[model samples]
Each structure stands twice: as structure tokens, then as C-alpha cells.
Target: MRLSAEQISHIRAVIHECDPEARIYLFGSRVDDHKKGGDIDLLIFSKHLTERDKRRIRLRLYDRLGPQRIDIIIARDLSRPFVRLAYAEGVEL
Candidate 1:
């Protein structure tokens, strides 16, 4: 995985602050060792996440993780096929 221990820790902490039961996954290019310079892709699973919740979690994560391209997929927002694949293949953080 592309993330360091500290990065994962921060992400987990931020997500848990938003929802303690949230399930976080690290996927896409960041999960594969062979890839390089990919944005952070995260699949967050929680019960009944609203737009407000998404925004809050996003802002908090960016604030803690710094300014970078981060792609987040809430479980209920799993519309695309690739996102499902990502959830299946993604490493849980």
C-alpha cells in the first residue's frame, strides 16, 4: 500500500470521528505496489451516510491529511462497477 502507518492512523481516526462504525478501504492504484503517483482512493462504508456527513468527513480528512487528490466512495454511493471491484480488492485500513 502507498500509505504509511501514520497516514492510515490519521484516516482511521478521522473516519471514526465521523462514524465509529465506518469501514474504511484503501483501493485503486494506491493499493498496488507496482503503481505510482496515484490519488488516494478510499471506500468508506457506514450506515445511512448523508451528503453532509460526506462533506464533514472529507473536509476533516483533507485538513488532517493535507491538500491532495483524494477519491472517496461511500458504500451507498457504490454505483459504478469498478467501485464494487475496488471494495472487493481494497485493503482495509
Candidate 2:
């Protein structure tokens, strides 16, 4: 799925509002123009994300997007080992 510039901007804005220090990235088929995909994939990195925070973020995104399919992978900032593996193995959006 290709994200429009406006869609990207809206996503970034919502992410920043949720966690200013968070690092937001896009990956998977959305990044690969040649591939066919069904949903938008996002990797969110933030040391401050608790379970409550995750729920809130998810709800907020759903409210803003309204039925648009989204796959959010949340990780901590210090989880570099896992992040690096994903970076190398995952498709970049």
C-alpha cells in the first residue's frame, strides 16, 4: 500500500503527539513499490511506551484513520539488537 504525502504527514503528527521522542518508521510491502499489500506497516520506537500507552496510541490511530488497516510494531529504544535485525531483514518503507 502506498501512503500519500498527506497520510504520512498525518501519521507523523499523531505519533509525535503520542510520544515526542518516539522514532517512527515504515517498512514491509508498503515500501516496496513492486509488491502488493493490504495494510500499512509501522515500527514505533520509544523507551516510554507502556501497555497503557500502547493502547492509547492504538486507539488514537484508529480514531484518526477510521478503518484503515494498520500494523504497528512497538519496540523500546534500547532494543538495538532486535531493531538491527529487523532493519536488515525487514523491507524498508
Candidate 3:
């Protein structure tokens, strides 16, 4: 599905508020014009990933987006190697 500019902005806003130091990358079909059938894919990297933070993010996004399907992968800064590999392999938004 094509995401509206507003939706992207909302997502970015939530990410910024939830984890100011986090790096968020959009990927999968949500960012690919040639592909079909997929939800918004987000890879989030931060120095902190506490349970409370995760719950807050999920709750905030669920409130904004409703039941919309979203694939979110949260990782730590130490996982840069794997995240970089995924990016290099064509996971771009």
C-alpha cells in the first residue's frame, strides 16, 4: 500500500518523540514502487530498548495508526553490522 506523506510524517514524529537518538529506516514494499503486498517496514536502532520504551512506542503508534499493519524491528546500536548489511542488500524506503 502507498503511504501518504502525512503518514510518513506522523511516523517520523512518533519515532523522534519515542527515541530521539534512534535511527529509523523504512524498507520493504512500502518503499518499493515495483512491489506489491506488504505493510510499512521499519528498522529502528537505538541505544535504549527497555520494555517501557517499547510499550510506549507501540501504544503511541497504535493510537495514531489504529489497526494498520506495521512491521517494526527494534535493535540496539551494537547491531550496526547486521543493520548495515540489510541496508546494503536493498532494504530502502
Candidate 2 lDDT by residue in tens digits, 55-79: 6766777787777778777887535
- C-alpha TM-scores of all predictions: 0.87, 0.75, 0.72
Q: Which stretches of candidate 3 lie over 4 Å from their true place?
A: 78-82, 89-93
Off by over 4 Å in 1: 76-80
Q: How close is candidate 3 to the true structure, as a TM-score?
A: 0.72
Which scores higher on TM-score, 1 or 3?
1
What's model 1's TM-score? 0.87
Whichever of 2 and 3 has more TM-score, that candidate is: 2
The best-first sequence of candidates by TM-score reads 1, 2, 3
**Alpha carbon lDDT at 1, candidate 3:** 32
Report, for every candidate in turn, its global Cα lDDT versus the true structure: 0.86, 0.72, 0.70
The residue-by-residue lDDT of candidate 1 on 1-93, one tens digit each, is: 989999999999988887888889998899988888889888998876767888888888899889978888887646779778988899999
Residue 7 error, candidate 1, Å: 0.5
What's the lDDT for candidate 2?
0.72
